[model samples]
Target: MDGATQFAVSALINILTSLICITLSWWVLQNVRLDLFLRNPGGIQGKMLQVLLSIVLGHGLAVFFIDYLGWSGMIGQLF
Candidate 1:
């Protein structure tokens, strides 16, 4: 791909990765009540903890998907 095309592909992948991560986090919290482990489960602290957990887990999963599974290459091909 040309430089411009490659840039666009990279941007698109980043956006999609973020969206997927947020969606997965929301789904897990809503359906699984995974934030119950927090001390103040219904307070701001709990909410912040949940957000942090989601971000870390999301990034970790994204790295695994891109590096270990080579899904990044598959996604790049789609663009």
Candidate 2:
């Protein structure tokens, strides 16, 4: 494929991966007991915190996965 097509495909994969990871993180976070650390776990601030945490954690995971895939793909160059 051309450079533009490859770039577009990569962008789409990144977006989908990020979104999937974010959703997975949010789902996993639901099991945590936020009340232990927050005075109002049900309040807007608490919800916002949850969202932020999910995004951070998810993005971190996504980065790791992307980097791993890239590195693995380069392994054949060693031959």
Evaluate model 2: give its TM-score: 0.96
lDDT of 1 by residue, 1-79 (tens): 8999988987788768866977697667666564556666779887777788788877776666556436656787897
- Number of the top candidate by TM-score? 2
lDDT against true structure, model 1: 0.72
Which run of 10 residues does model 2 get worst, by summed lDDT? 69-78
lDDT of each: 0.72, 0.95
Candidate 2 local distance difference test against the native: 0.95
In model 1, what is the error at residue 48, expressed in angstroms? 0.6
Clashing residue pair totals per candidate (backbone < 3 A): 0, 0
70: Cα error in model 2, Å: 0.5
For candidate 1, give the lDDT of residue 26: 61
lDDT tens digits, residues 1-79, model 2? 9999999999999899999999999999999999999999999999999999999999999999988978997997889
